[model samples]
Target: MTATSVGALLLCRADPEAVRPPAHLLRERMLLLPAGTGWSVLVPEGKPWRGEPHDGPDAAPAAPAAPGGAEPVDRVMGGWATALAVGATWPVIALWWDGDRSGYTLAAGFRRPVGYVWLADGTPAGEDEAMRTFAARLSLDPVLDVQELEALTRQDPEADADARLRELLAVLTRAGVALPPGLAPGEPADRLRTAAGVHPQVERIEWAGWRDAVQVELDAVESTGLGPWVRGPRARALAAAQVAAGIPLTLWGARRRGAGWLAAGLVLLVQGALGLAYDRFRAEAERGARGGGPVW
Candidate 1:
């Protein structure tokens, strides 16, 4: 693929409605659209990786720097995938390609992300075990899907990086992923954004400040009947954990100026804060019901 074809797509194994709330927490402009039965695709409007180098104190020591200090496409997408999947039930698969390489990073829950890469010429550059892990995480057909994924890791003279990505998507079709027309792999980031913007069902996501974001998240949780998990000591402990994890992570991201980690840390902090607030609110309401006093 040409350098100009640098682009990435975040495929979430969830409906757009479920993906919207956490997506807003990313604080980046993106276009969301349904992919298939239970899949959604997020096309980022800005290419932050192409911008100024993240040399801040929070910058990740291992983050690879591209020419002019820009973060590599894979690194940026991988971070974003992790951010999106951290507190959500569904997994996020980030498919990214640049002039020199192409790969996919799959992040689910708090587990370590797993991925495989290929050179621009389609030579596999990752471990074979990664494919097995990928298939297992997605719950794809153990024998059939594993065989197909393994094929992508083998040498293929006719396939280029773009072709490899396409083949990977082909295997995912069985798991209900049908990308919209013109949203194909290897397209330029601007073009991908344009394509996503045109879809009739596309929804634009932007940073709307913490107040709005927290409200949306709370509404989502309530509507999804997740309130039970938002109250009680267990929930409070989880919130505390999130806050504890987020502080250091946010600090690290700030120091390094890494968007992915920053987003992740912010998400954790917000979610933790929300959890604490919700728990308190519910407790007061119950107390008021028992004639203790007004909740407010």
Candidate 2:
């Protein structure tokens, strides 16, 4: 019998803080950690089957249950990745594999998600349209990027899923994603954690339950470096503009079920609100200083 394992990595093109998912929002098996510059990776303890029927006699192991209904590992990974991408300003690439297949899905702003699939034996099982879309969204150089992607589809028949992922990574190197050493496809969660722990940039994130998770998120927001700009008139105007722009973008996304755009709109709204509030607080501090009150 062939041994089997399933794994996924969530690649983010922003600061680790931007990529950190709230612990309260995740099922038990998922852990988020920094991968490298402009990148974070989510490692699932196992599959995320969560109360669904298996495909057939050869189905992969069931994932830990969550509130939502169950789905296949690949679908679950795609949805999870899209949710993360939709919540932030940058794109997110979810790379996943089971014993029999491997694939990647890229989710970016307001656009339909794009992805490519490959059989375990390295056979191309994805649409060329997905490749074209992937390249276009990332602003990759057309000729070079397409050539590398096309080469993946034409790899030797004996090439396995691991090789396929490595090839994909090579193409993304130009996009400034350099995954830290020891983080790669096919590693067990335990080993992935151990490897991630030693890396200088990796910050391990575990579920701390709901209340604590909320507090953590709030604290992070407060510490962000918005003080200087928020206090300025021009910056305040920009903030107001963001608020103006966000509302319609958000509503449109909801009306159309556009997860990526919804996320971008929400981020804009939150940042704008924070900017306005920061201005108010800074003005109060300056007033207290002028009045010779406790300058806080």
Candidate 3:
């Protein structure tokens, strides 16, 4: 299959660890790596649209129903983007392509996703409404941003997918997304990896085996401000829910050969276990700090 058929990049304004949760939620086997300052890239290993996880209640209407059937790609990207954006302080963008089309979706917070589309030949196929929505969702200056966006849509129809993506990137430069030299759109996963590894600003994210990974996660928690939730009843509840949800998810993914979902379940398990551990650690630390005053 060609690059368009199997390759996609999910860009998020969070670190790779923060990016993993939502990607797992989408059940996609994506390689996570740093993409430049304040950004991470998720490279989907397989076609994400084939067996997308259900989006539950807040899901937008299915993508196949979208104009020109562009929603299939959009939904997966949108779902992942929205998952990362909600309950966080950053936005996520999914740049995707299939054999016949290419487009992008920008999701921020709980607001609706806005996207732009292009035909396989690079003909602009998205509605002006999408650009308007895109600008609004990002809180861009109404006059200046809209003008730049409008100019993008008005680009020469003969431009190819690569050109279109470049134009999109140009528009996003202000948002601090400086993708590395080798992380080009439409490259196969292997080629994408080879390039990303040597790029000065890119770092290949890996399991580093479970023990090291877990320790790294614990260390991460120390630097984050999740102390209240991680030390309270809500953290316990969330950890329990993650375990409960992860088992079935992992089983289901294994049965269906869904690498994405399987990875997602594993993440949930890790997060849940870590939350519990962090809470216990906090309790112990508190007791020690207070001279072991009855162990709370």
Report every candidate's CA lDDT.
0.87, 0.71, 0.68
**In candidate 1, what are the lDDT values of residues 1-296, reduced to their tens digit?**
23466889999999998999999999999999999989999999988775222233422233455466767778888998999999799999999886667789999999999998887789898889999999999999999999999999999999998999999999999999999998988898999999999999999999978866876776577666565567778789999999999999999999999999999999999999998998888677658858967544
lDDT of 3 by residue, 71-115 (tens): 355566777778768856778888876545667888888887788
User: What TM-score goes with each of the models?
Assistant: 0.71, 0.66, 0.60
RMSD (CA, Å), each prediction:
14.6, 11.4, 15.8
Number of clashing residue pairs, candidate 2: 3
- In model 1, pairs of residues that clash are 56-255, 57-255, 57-256, 58-252, 58-255, 58-256, 59-255, 59-256
Q: Note the residue pairs that clash in candidate 2.
A: 47-63, 49-63, 86-263
- Which regions in candidate 2 have their CA more than 4 angstroms from the true location? 1-4, 21-24, 27-30, 45-47, 50-70, 207-217, 220-225, 228-296
lDDT for model 2, please.
0.71
> Tens-digit lDDT track for model 2 on 1-296?
12236666778777777656442355445555665566667666555543332343444555554566556556877887777677667888888776677789999866778888777778787777788788888788799988888877775876787788888888888877777777787764456656766766556565667654664564456457863454578668988999999999999899999999899899999989988887777578668868987534
Question: Regarding lDDT, does 2 or 3 come out ahead?
Answer: 2
Judge candidate 1 at residue 133 and give its lDDT: 96
Candidate 2, residue 90: lDDT: 83
Clashes of each: 8, 3, 3
lDDT of 1: 0.87
In terms of lDDT, the poorest run of 10 residues in model 1 is 51-60
Q: Which structure among the candidates has the greatest lDDT?
A: 1
Provide the lDDT at 53 for model 3. 19
